[model samples]
Target chain A: MQPEIQPAPSPASLAREDDVLEAAVRWRAEGKAVALATVLETWGSAPRPVGSHLVIDDTGNFLGSVSGGCVEGAVVTEAMDVIDSGKPRTLEFGVADEAAWRVGLSCGGAIRVYVERID
Target chain B: MDLALLTALNTERAARRAAVVVTHLASGVQRLVRGEDITSDPLAGDIEAAVRAGRSGVAGEGEARVFLNVHVPPARMVVVGAVHISQALAPMARATGYDVTIVDPRTAFATAERFPDTPVIAEWPDKALPGLALDPFTAMVALTHDPKIDEPALEAALKAGCFYVGALGSRRTHAKRMERLAALGLPQAQLARIHAPIGLDIGAANPPEIAVAILGQVIGALRKPAPAREAAA
Candidate 1:
């Protein structure tokens, strides 16, 4: 005998990072400026794994995630700057950042995010 | 940030081909490497190895710093039974990142109330399997004790080149099944692909434990190299 069955949650987010990449490509092809940010590395109890991504367009629209909201705002901010300057930059966030403290990741983890404009 | 490279990735994904996107961080140069087209890329060996393992990560340092974003089609599982084992296996398979579909013609067994997480197709395997598009990333399991239900699914799995195929049966049952399949013109090589006992012999006495064993075996067959898997089998 089996218990009452509940509908399983959709696993649509499994390829979310790839979706962001595809979206970035499409946005660029449409002549909209776009920047791609990836979690190149992480340490301690980081919320997201390495290779997590956040793709941002010029209008501030974004997709995917480099962190569990702990560092997306900062990454988005850096992403916009990268899109404007056409220069790639690396960002670091941990409990050390007061902003990170305000959001979360109070678990004391650090992450290295790289942002580059997709030309 | 190369549009060409990104476009290539999108194309490969659309074709359901596995690939890896390699990017050099400092210079921000990127290239898309499909598993089959690795020889054309300078980083052929490394990128192919990474994609085969289905893992993405950063390698090297300084100017050589490379990020490999491995991409493979999502894993899928086709279960040919709406029995108790499927009730346990479907959810467990979903938890293990498999897109599961349960196929059982018996409406009483293959109902939404029984397999809430998967698409329950109330059609025989021969009728339902073709639409599922079982591929290298798929694992097929025939859990129905009835040969009418399980054999057709097993045939479809072998023909489709599914990565893992298992059927629930005891040793004597499997011996009889092998005879029947052989008489049906399935080659020895194709018939060998079936893991007749279904799950790993881990002293599994209940449905959930059996499900775990089956999923574990499927994962092993998926993750291990073919030669190594042959040796283990």
Candidate 2:
């Protein structure tokens, strides 16, 4: 009988940031459309650091987080558009922006995110 | 965000090498810069500064806008003894974002029950360290006080060019260690990199306090520029 093959485990040495990039590459290899969002800059008590990443697939699935669960929904929504249009976009969220209030960055901080399709 | 570039970046990361992604926000044009290749890049100065500080952010303004996404391997700490100090040190190191591993040949001291969530390797340093792949981003600490165990690990850390190499001992103990290491044919210059009488002289009265001092010294070695000889490579 053919031996059952177990899926390889991710190395314990990989940091959380590395996992996001690794996920992006793995998704692309599977022929899934992917978009990557990165926190470009932050002001005040931002939920995540500037280099934090959130990767989204065409099916609205995501790995990693770009915020304290406050703004990921909006970022993922914007990322689907980026995947469909193949055009990069910059998004801003903060208590200062009225629209952001609806989504709520209730942490009273501002962040700029860059979203791009991974072709 | 080219697939080729993304794959290359992931490959570098998996190998624990540093890399930077320079993205032109306006045009969505991006390129990956390997750490070893940074000195030859056009933005060498700015990128080098960012890499040293371990930060990533936007650079340039308006029409020339770009984002420098720096990816340095997470710093690791390999403690050479699973002693009382290590029990306190491991949790503290983890809280500060360091991946901590404890190595000791004494199975009595290297128990998982003692280390809890941390990795404990009950093997001699000579056998265990070679597989760890010590690198510039790693910090090694020898707390065993036993020459047989600690010396081999210290030698490995020095040869690997680990950013920090510290040992717990008094000044006299270190002086004796230096002579023995030199007798083993290790150059005096290389032996000098070991921070004997380890940790800052902060008058630590207990294991936990000493752990703080040692952690502080490790952070200082990481953040501050080292002397010319150590930085030569």
Candidate 3:
């Protein structure tokens, strides 16, 4: 006989990763303007691997991390502009850029983040 | 990053299916590729490689450059015997990022006190495994050494195309199993997939060491190139 099957349980880490995108969908459904920032590339000792997501809302609320607590403030600030303009922006963070000096990766790594509004 | 596309991505994730989000950095234009459609995608070559490696990165060059964000369901390990080896393997599998579950009809062996922090189902494999919805992402290990218990679980795992299928037995025991399975109508090709005398040949002499060997074998089956795995099978 064919038995009723249930979906397998997801690992905690995978669930955490999905939580980022799930929150973006949830926030957007709640009428909150949302922006998603994804780590497109990373070099050297990157804290988070590529594909890590950081979701932000118009009110400056956010979930997830694109870096090790560094550069998130800047990414959130940039995400607000993305929400307003509806234009995607790519931000690069590293010790090499002067802007990054203000919000640098303390791990001496470099990363490129793509921030886009969920319209 | 359209809400529709984001929603679609999450839907695929919740269903435990693989998908990729291809985003053009210059134009901010994006598209979602479900696992089944990857072969027909324009960037099929790159997307296939990225999905296989379970990685995300920038592809192409210049204005045509795009980011491929790969999402694959986490691997799962389902042990059919809640015995001594499971006591060691469950925690190790969790640490290595696999969702783990143990099933055995013998309630005494599958007790919560013996497997703290691990999910133990005190039901026969035939009853419990069907509800688990064994899939390609799952690794199945049958360790009870009792044909009545282990055989059915192995059969189910094989039929489900589990990424890894293993059974603990000596060569003689495995040979007898092959005959029994063949008589039950499983094809030779499918039967060849079972890793009898399970685990990597690491000279393990105890339950914990045997668990290490099995976990290593499962990881290798999951990560190694597809062609190589087929050859080994």
Candidate 4:
């Protein structure tokens, strides 16, 4: 609880919930479309743990991460769709998926990410 | 997706308050539930369990599936002593995902040169630890053999209910220290929280090895719940 030295605030670093949530707040206040993709669950050798986030603006700009670098490209792409459709999409990717190697989730794990538009 | 909800959530985060952001996927609805408010939540049981474990996950099924994004404050380690053992333990704690702080009133020992890239507060633990707001997410270690320093810190740590309290000493030294603490009117149950003769009995003979043992025990205490004891009168 000691407010000591703030660690590195990178998405790939220790999960900084404040930074990501604050970014979402900033994006909304700016009137830009925002989508929040949260790692709902993980199985096997997932890179990032559950509750990780990747907040994406309509412009494809993002902060934080749900699956490290793996599957983020696909998530961002789906996030854009969610923004347009004003809907939520749950994306599941795994080693068994044909696109797993392409998306770099080749760590022999599966992850479910729920992407929802937050206007 | 409510702006008011997001605003409230950010406010709590700024205050370092524990909360869980429950997002219902199908309807794209989300609500921020704080610690005290969880009991009233429909998902109270799930949220409480998640809060206790400090983890977040999906709960329910089908359209009712909700993502419980837990927002507990980061775990911290407050090492009270700027000795070589502290120099070794601080970074190890940081590597293991703890916000590490070194507290020692001796400015010469608690120098930035000795512990770079970490906060070193030159204040007594009784004064400094209270301001740190030690909680269950925090672990405190007293490496200074001086009872004047270590005892005050241990008292503050135990009173604050830190997840782990460890003091460096031999069995005989701990007994003597306990006698002193007992004189201070701290009950036996409270003193039981201290893991004196500190660390797992790993036969560590050097500073670095002892540091490893300490971190190992701290991690064990954090990861595993303490054994149940008889209820206090």
**Whose lDDT is greatest here?**
3
lDDT of 3 by residue, B65-86 (tens): 9999999998999998998999
Model 3 residue pairs with clashes:
none
Q: Please write out the lDDT profile of model 4 over residues B1-233, one tens digit for every residue.
A: 66678778767766556899998878777889997799899999899778767899988999898889998877899999999999999889999999999999888899999999999999888778877878877999999998999999999888888888999999899999999999999999899889988887789999999999999888877655344211210
Ranking by lDDT: 3, 2, 4, 1
Clashing pairs in 1: none
Model 2 earns a TM-score of: 0.90
TM-score (chain B) of candidate 3: 0.94
Give lDDT: candidate 2, residue B101.
Answer: 96
RMSD per candidate (Å) reads 7.8, 3.7, 4.6, 6.1
User: Which candidate, 1 or 2, would have the higher TM-score against the true structure?
Assistant: 2
Q: Which stretches of candidate 2 lie over 4 Å from their true place?
A: A1-18, B227-233
| Second chain TM-score, each model | 0.89, 0.91, 0.94, 0.84
Per-residue lDDT tens digits for candidate 1, residues B1-233, read 77777777766765567888888877777777777788788877677667667777888778898888888887889999999999999998899888999999999998999877688999999899887778878899999899999988888888888999999999899999999999989999999989978887799989999999999999888888778787766
lDDT of 1 by residue, A60-103 (tens): 98988988887788788788889889988888888888776776
Residue B10 displacement in candidate 1 (angstroms)? 2.1
**DockQ of candidate 4 relative to the true structure:** 0.35
Native interface contact recovery, all models = 0.75, 0.91, 0.88, 0.59
Report the lDDT tens digits of candidate 4 across residue range A4-87.
896345333232444887889888978999988889899998989898889999999999988888899999999999999987
- Residue B3 lDDT (model 4): 62
What would the TM-scores of all predictions be?
0.86, 0.90, 0.91, 0.79
Docking class of 1: acceptable
Per-prediction DockQ comes to: 0.38, 0.64, 0.56, 0.35
